[model samples]
Target: MATLLHIDSSVFPGEASSTRSVADAFRATWEERHPQGTVIYRDLAAHPVPHITADAWSAGYAAAAERTPAQSAAFALRVELMEELERADAVLIGAPMYNFSIPSTLKAWLDNVLLLGRTAGETPSVEGTPTVVVASRGGSYTPGTPREGYEFVQNYLEAVLGGTMGLDVDFIVPELTMAGRNPALSALVPLYEASRERAFGEAVGRAKELAERFAA
Candidate 1:
């Protein structure tokens, strides 16, 4: 059976977080289709991974026989994260926008897993793996929007996950997430609701589509 690596980096739990909610729909649909398949889940908000350190950074460049004890210990966790990424046939990420960027916890996980000679570089191990990112944001940032130039979440991730790691990446954006909470954006609630509905549909559809592409 195929393995799905699902990561939720939103601070809010369950339905409170737009990204998490959309990702949950995707995972539920995937599980329903692949009853016997495996899922490796990580809740980065609840249990944040250690940020990259000097020891961890240095160890990746050192040969097996040259690494010190500290480097070995630091590199162990990085190896574990990378192994999970490598073993997965498909990946699902809940990358909610925060300050026009990704959560720091998600960044930490990316730092640990992005080894130069391993997950990164030409002909990477998981180069062709399918990845779906749920990019939920507080406001609309479409191409024609006033603040479209401020969009960094999708652009940054496209470079890292698609360009650097070589994964085949797709995004399901649920925009205007703050419409219900922000008084100033009350008029845009209708658009936000529509976007949310669209995101859920995309998530479920993408899961089923990917399920058909691989054998158990």
Candidate 2:
């Protein structure tokens, strides 16, 4: 059976978080399409990966036989994380915007998994794997908007996952998620609902399509 790595970095759960909702729809559809497929899930908000430390960084570049005990343990996790990425036929990331970028937890996971000589070094281990990122933001940042250049989630992810790792990455973003929650964004509630609907719809469709395509 094919393997899928599903990672969610949202601090909030259920209906409160747009990223979670869209990810849930995608996962559900993907499972329906490939019931026997293997799913390796990591909820970063609950069980966040460790940030790369000086020791870990040093260990990552060292020959495996030369790593010290502490470095060995730290580097071991990195190996496991990279192995998951390598084994998966597809990857799904639920990343909510935090301060105009991805959550720290998600960033930490990326740091652990994107190891040199494993994930992208030597040759890209996950090259050509389909990676779907559900990038949810509280406000809109489309072109010409005041926050246009401030949006960094998708761009940064594309640079790392697509540009660097050579993954076939696609993004599904649900913007203006705070419209009904925050008083300042209350006026955009209708637009927020429309955007949410469209995002979820596309997410579900994309999930099924990818699952079907990869099942072959």
Candidate 3:
């Protein structure tokens, strides 16, 4: 059976936020499809990693090639996060766009997971796996459209998650605030709900197919 890691970085818990709900829905669908598979969850909001400090940066650089005493000590805490991703057959990340960018907490988690020569490197195939990113945004960010100005989040994430790591990145975006006035929001509510369901179902299906093909 495959191992799946489900991560959520949304700070809000209730209806005020949709990231967690979206992630939960995805995890549920995946569980149903892969009954024998193991699913591990990490909530960054409840347990966040401190921002990378000077010491952490120094350790990371010092141990860029091999682990040192200082680097090993600092990296001990991050190893759990890295091991989780490394052992997983697939990864599902749910994050909300904050100020046209990803949350710092999520970025921190990425930094820990995208270790040199581990998750990525100068090698041709840096990433040895596939990942799906489900981004929840309050506005539309389709390029070439009027709201294209707000597309930095998706662009930045794709660059890091796909280009740098060489992971097959798939995205699901549920535009929330773009629906406009109360009446429009009311109309959009059902659409968002339906989109969430479809997105989760599709992700679960894809993950299952991948597991059967690669992990079997």
The model with the greater TM-score, 1 or 2, is 1
Each prediction's whole-model lDDT (CA): 0.95, 0.90, 0.72
Candidates arranged by lDDT, highest first: 1, 2, 3
Winning model by TM-score: 1
Enumerate residue pairs that collide in model 1. Answer: none
Off by over 4 Å in 3: 14-16, 63-70, 124-126, 177-201, 211-215
Inter-residue clash pairs, candidate 3: none
RMSD of every candidate to native, in Å, equals 0.7, 1.1, 3.3
Q: Which ten residues in a row have the lowest lDDT in candidate 3?
A: 176-185
| Of 1 and 3, the candidate ranking higher by TM-score | 1
- Using lDDT as the yardstick, the better of models 1 and 3 is 1
How does candidate 2 score on lDDT? Answer: 0.90
* lDDT score for residue 63 of model 2: 83
Q: Write the per-residue lDDT of candidate 3 for residues 46-150, one digit (tens) a residue.
A: 888766655555665564567666677677766677788778777888878888888888989887766666666675233656677878787667767567887
Residue 4's C-alpha lDDT in candidate 3?
Answer: 81
